[model samples]
Target: MVNAPAEQKKLPSWWSGGSVVYQIYPASFKDDDGDGYGDLRGIINKLGHIKSLGVDAIWICPHYKSPRVDEGYDISDTDIHEPFGTREDCQELIDAVHAHGMKIMFDLVVNHCSDQHAWFKESRSSKTNPKRDWFYWKPPRMIDGVRHPPNNWRSCFGGSVWEWDEHTQEYYLHYFCSEQPDLNWENPETRQAIYNDAIRYWLDRGVDGFRIDTVNMYSKYLDFPDAKVVAPETPWQPAGDFFSNGPRLQEFLREMRKEAFSKYDCFTIGELPNTPSLEKILSYISTDAEALDCTILFDLADLDHRGGQYPLMGRNWALSQFKALTAFAQQLAEPEHKAHALTYLENHDQARSVTRYASDAPEHRLTSSKLLATYLLTLSGSVIIYEGQEIGMINAPKDWDIDTEYLDVNTINTWREIKHDAKVQNDPSLLERGRAGIQLTARDHARTPMQWDGSKNAGFSSNPDAKPWYRVMESYAEGLNVGAQEDDPNSTLNFYRQLVSLRKAHKDLFILGRFQLLDPGNDQTMLFTKTALDGSQVAFVALNFSAEKQPFELPIELTARQSQLLISTLGKSSESRELDAYEARVYLA
Candidate 1:
């Protein structure tokens, strides 16, 4: 670990209490060098724009040295990638972010490393190599003189998790893609190297903290056992039960906290997928545990998922269901738990919230977007806003054919699988249905370049002749561009600004207050009240989720006393009990 004095920068005690994070997909954010890809310098250029959103921190997606497989998640090295810029550029970005009074969080993907990593290369060189234990390698199982994989585990991308090396005559486990091999965290040497070389390397450079990628999947069962087959026909099956939140996850986290994180005043949040239970989740972030500051659980994101499969298409969720889920989430983060909550509506892995939760119809789109913003900002937790979310960006145009136009690896793989299944079933119509599914849920929808202006390539790059690395959304010139909304008082971008300002102004009422759900029986409306623990402050937020106006009656006791309208999407006096379609109102009661 680098013992830099600058790494010990002091942080406020209230840093985690009421902070807002804005997530940036670096490659799609901007192109400063005109190389058709976003680089570190591009992020430096947009600091002012991000600062205008009133976010406390920015969570930059992985820009580490990689083969661009899985969009930089497959890291060949922990250093800055050449395409993004040199290590100096990264340090400048960090310093620039701090200058704006905002912190920066880097994406830390340590569950695995690219097969091309030096350690992985050395491990694969020979069976007797000293670094052979750095990765999981097992002898192949032989059945009737036929060689087969040691177990039935499957890779997340597709196919078997084990790949046999002809030269080494052994199989190495890779839960993700064959190009990415799972690191042997069980080895003390591997654990120490990751902490000393990678984690401290960034912290020493003035990074605030990390959003730990797949934090719960660090450990595995000692025995390489077979996974239960959930789908017999498919080449890949769900093996998360055997690997996700594995046996030694908490132990390893505590070790990390004591060894690396404890050295500096920093923030740490984990991208924990497939977490088993609410009790288990609380343990990870609970103050008593001291493992992590917070975690992003996928329970809310999977609300409408089909059979809990993230890639498969799912149905629209009801307003009542949304209310129930949020209420449960609030309960989990109750003050008694003394745990930090990382709440968000959109991120790099999911489609835009405007398209997922709100009606995309032109007439209702703006109102729905505002309604979701109110819910996001008013919720009692630290909030995260994805890039382009403030400007009301929608999913990629419905006409952009997934087979030809989309470049997201996840979308491409899922589309191919869907089409293959359709062909095997001899149903041509399924191909069209599969296309629609991909259009609705593909991660590409969120990967489109940021809409900076109405210019060609959406002003993401200055070179007029340069094409973006990914397809820019077709709706940019029509009004979704940032330049068009900057001056408009009623624009979605302005609405987000106002909402964030409101949250910052009333940190005690919105951030430190206890959240209580109201009118749980209302299926077309969601209502909640945030009240300070001492009962000195209280606010009620009402949302009309349906397409038609709804009548709402305030509690008799509340209406008996005078109440002040704080904010509303309808931009009208909040005296009436009737709410317009997609209306959201916050009242100081």
Candidate 2:
């Protein structure tokens, strides 16, 4: 165990309060040396911008040494931050964030590793190898003189999960991509090695915590039963329920907690998809539980469909959908031993929220942005804001393509499969274009180089000719740069500044308060209030579904002489008691 320095005295209250955590997608954040990708030095340069947002922590996406199969998620080394910069650069980032009074949370992708990783390479070389059992390798069945996969499980990118290894004469299951071989957590040695090495590597580097990728899938059923085939031939996988949250999960977590996380006041949030049952989440992050500190449930993100419910396609989002998502969050927050849920509108894997909600109009886009901010910040859990969310960045324009070359292996493979499918043959050009139009919609949209100025390359890189690995939105060249936004008070950047400041100042009501639903029966709109223990009642909310102004009355009988409008997306709340289209308001009642 790494010993803590004697000078350290206390830990920050990141868990029990509303702490603003900024997520940085390193590759597209900014390029310092013009390497065509973002680096640690670039992040250090942007510390002032992060601080200006009044956030308390920053979640740096994977920088670990890897083959970059799945961005940096397919990590080969747990101890170092690779091509992005040196180990010292990572330490420098942690130190810089600390200097700004903010914490740093690194991405930890322990569920799998790139096929090129030393461990996977060794495990696949021979059946008798010492590391042979390190990964989920199975003997191929002899069928009609040909080898067949042990089961019919599909991968996340779509298609069979098993990959035939000619060298080992066996098949290995990869839940994500063929390149990302899933680790066998059934092995004690493998689990211990990852825990000891990864936790020590970052803890020693002084990182505040980690955001775990697919934490629930670490443990699998010993039987390895084939999941119910949702799509047998086409390659679409289900939630992996039979293989997730296995018997050994808690055991493995307690070991990790005992060996590493418990030593320091660290925070860990798991990425558990389709984990709808509250019991499953509670066991993982309850204060007295055996595992992590929190988790990012897929409920809200999955609820985003296009059929006026939640649309994953690059179609416009409905205000009703936004309201429904927040209502779900409000319910999750009420669990007595609720595992802190990370509420978000967009992330590196999803499409941009602005484009998902607002059509091609900037006015509606900005209004929807505020509406989301109001709903997100009002929740009682940790809030993770994606890189470009602050300025209301939208999805990539339909004309923009070229995402496959920049996407990770699994993402590219999935796009190719979708393109090849006859079902979507109507838009054959989309496949030739790499589904750069939709499959990679959200991330690529958010990954556009941080708009720094109307400079040559949005001021993200020094060379205008250098390919940025991802296309930059054309707006940067038109005056959407950071410099321009800094001067314009009306810019999306300033509005975010005000939004964050309001969240920080009202911590008691927002962070430590109880969330109560105001219009519980209304599916068309979401309205809620936060009542602090100290009797400071703050009515927090948003109106997203319909274009018409929605009328709402207070749930409680309040005799206050006047309601003070703290913040409103629509003009003054006092003047307009009725909500305008996509309007959000905060009031002191």
Candidate 3:
């Protein structure tokens, strides 16, 4: 247990109430040593930029040693990766973020480890090994003359979740790629190791908190039953029914809190996907619950899709649907709940939000970016802004080659599978449509390197000849880079900066207020209000989701004389309540 030093007495929790977290996908953030990959050193240098954003915390994605099979989530060891720098560099980052008056949250991916991890190595060596039970190793079932996996569970990357081990003559379960094997959380020793070695290790290193990756999947259905048939196209099916929010989930989280988290002055934000309902979420994050401080919710992110987090599965979302979800989300902000809502639109695992949620076309991109930013900032929660989101980054251009520029494992597997399905079905249009959908929803869109300037490499790396690990959005090199937007008063980056400041000035309304989602059934306009719990402050927010102008009236009997204009995306306050294309305005009502 690492107690907070007297000098850092306030470190116990700094992420609640009006705190905005700036998420850094480290590899794509910035490269300090001309290595073409962003690292801890790069983040250390960018501390000023983060502090200037008016954010209180920074959530950095995985930097641990890995085989790079799943973009660093397949961690091999808890040690800092050599590519990201050394353990000392990580410590420096933690200290640097503190020195800049911001807390740092490390990405904790305890759901699985790389196949090359020492524990996995020892577990797979022999059936009698002490660590044999450290990972899920099950005997294969014999069908006819051939051996088959224990069940029809599918991996997140789209295949059987079980991989056969030749030497052991058995199969190991992996919810993701075969290279990333699931740790046996059912084992007490394994759970202890995760808490003592990984969770507590970073806490002791002085990291302010953690953004736990896939926290809900730690426990599993002991029976490993065949997953229900969601897609009959293949035998393997999504095993969410058997694994998500498993029976022992709360017990494990309570134990985790007692074992490590509660002992330290830190916070934890869980990556909790497949949430059944708001009630389920409240159970995880409510003040009385000994679980997560906050959870990365997906209700808003999942609105534009049929399948959760899977690419090429697209669906058109109604503005009413978006309004309903946000309204549903507001239940967490009630005083009775005492739950801190961790809200976001973009993250490393998903595509850019501006492209998915709003118009990203050149004509509407800027206005819509501000519109979405307004929506995100005004929500009664701690907002998380993805890297490049402030400058309005969009999806990868359609002309870009999927086979070359795109590199996410999920994107690659889905692309190949769709190509095969298209060819077998002899539908060229099918392939074209698949390509378009994949391009539109690909994770690679978020994985693109940061655009800092108009340099050859978008100023991400010092050496112009050193190519970034991923492609930079070429169109952004000119006007959309930070260097350009930083100077433009009306730029998306500046607009975000303004909103952050405004939110802080009125934290009572945004942070401790009761949210009332109004006109939720309106297909074109979204209107909401956040009133302080003590009724001291009231904030009225109006947004137009459509590209064309929309007429909106305040349901409440109010006029320009009764309200104070705070800020507007159109850069001017007007007596007219009519909303322009993609316009957003907040009023002190």
Best by TM-score: 3
Write one digit per residue (lDDT tens) for candidate 1, span 1-589. Answer: 2325334434443356767999999999989999888899999999999999999999999999999888898999888889799888998899999999988989989999999899999999998899999999999999899898888876666668899988899999998888889999999999999998778888887888888998988988868787676767664566777768778889999999888887776789897777747788888888788798888877778665544223545666677788877887776557888887778888888888877777767788789889999999998778889999998888887878777898877677667777787789888876776676677777788898999998998999867578889989877887888899999999899999999999989988888788888889888888888887788778888899888999887654357567788999987786788889899999887
TM-score of 3: 0.96
Regarding TM-score, does 1 or 3 come out ahead?
A: 3
What are the models' TM-scores? Answer: 0.95, 0.90, 0.96
lDDT-best of 2 and 3: 3
**After TM-score superposition, what is the CA distance of residue 219 in candidate 3 from its true location, in Å?**
0.8
Per-residue lDDT of 1-589 in model 2, one digit per residue for the tens?
A: 2337333423554555656789999988988878778888999989999899888899988887777767777787764555478877877888889989998888888888888889999999898989988899988868799777776665666566789999878899788778889998878899888877777667776888888888888887767665665554443445356647878788777777777676676888788775667677778777668578777876556544322111223344454555555656555455465556568878887777765554336547667777777767767767888887887767666665444334545455555565565355576654444443353353556667787777777878766677787778876655456777786676667777887787767766776667766665675567777876567565556454456677766445233525567877764546555777777777766
How many backbone clashes can be found in candidate 3? 0
lDDT tens readout by residue for model 3, 103-210:
888888888899999999999999999999999999998899788899998788877899999999999999989999999998999999999888878887788788
C-alpha RMSD for every candidate: 2.2, 3.6, 2.2
Per-residue lDDT, model 2, residue 406, is 40
Model 3: lowest-lDDT 10 consecutive positions = 1-10
Best by lDDT: 3
Better of 1 and 3 by lDDT: 3
